[model samples]
Target: MTTESSDARPLPTLTRRSGDDLRCSIARTLQVLGDRWTILIVREGFRGHTRFSDFRRVLGIPTDILTSRLSSLVEAGVLERRGYREPGARERFDYHLTAAGDALLPVLGALAEWGNEYRPSGHGPSRLYQHAETGEATSIAFVTAAGAVVPLTDIAIVPGPGENDPGVGPTHPLAAHH
Candidate 1:
């Protein structure tokens, strides 16, 4: 099913105030990327589009809103801005997703897959990815080399003393990150 703009994933709703510990890695990551348009911008960047006008045209996003989102993404190091110029035209800005942003593609793909499965749809997915080698419709799943599907599992932490706990390292990979 093709998700419409109105399809029911609501905007992220986390808030932090001064002196609050938004220190968890997941929370910190969300703080930078939790904005509605950030991932979409990364998506487009991966598609080889760089210029402001290209993004504006493809996304149909408002210019100011796009500007703000782009700015935020750049500030967060998810994107890099570079200048380009055309003959007889003004210098223009372009954006490209950084490695950190590209790393989120799998996460986005997973979310898209979930929405397709659970959401009601008279038709099946609007589009399907095909396996190039076999020419069969394909989707991504977490599986072992032996083809065993893996279920999500809780990750346990072994902490040492330092910052996270008394003897923990200065930064816990699981804590306060983006």
Candidate 2:
């Protein structure tokens, strides 16, 4: 079933406190998706499980926890809830991933790659990402704006604009560059 709604409205922007706030993007992202169940729910969404029952059945998530995660996701704009009704049944909602949620594909891919390397199941990957048309295997990487794929060894964490805030102390040696 499709989750697109003709009357769908844009989600509100989430506001974070400025100055003295943790300047870590990863930490900020984790604020919304730090829990195991939240990530698994998003995985289920990618697997095309839109309805609550489907998510419960696939993940074996408890109803209360599943309900809380879905609600949090919808609040965080990761999932959009669309109402539907069947025959004479009351209207219910199906959760679909928003653009923000869909953006987590690479995060999931990277996690899968790491798990396959460090926490293998002894058999092989249960899932593999591939190019839709070419059918070639795909993996996540750090690519530059000019399209250069940088190796992990070459990556350096530099201070960003947020890191330059007066309240935030220089935690990295490169902070002087800003």
lDDT scores for all predictions? 0.67, 0.82
> What is the C-alpha lDDT profile of model 1 across 23-101, one tens digit per residue?
3555566767776677777778877888898999988999999998898777776788999888999888899877666
Candidate 1 runs further than 4 Å off? 1-15, 18-21, 120-123, 126-149, 153-178
lDDT of 2: 0.82
- Top candidate when judged by TM-score against the true structure: 2
Give a tens-digit lDDT track for model 2, residues 46-100: 9999999999999999999999889988987889999999899999999999987
Q: After superposition, how far is residue 36 of candidate 2 from its true place, in Å?
A: 0.6
Supply the global lDDT for candidate 1: 0.67
TM-scores of all predicted structures: 0.65, 0.81
Candidate 1, which ten residues in sequence have the lowest lDDT sum? Answer: 2-11
Off by over 4 Å in 2: 1-22, 164-178
Q: Point to the candidate with the largest lDDT.
A: 2
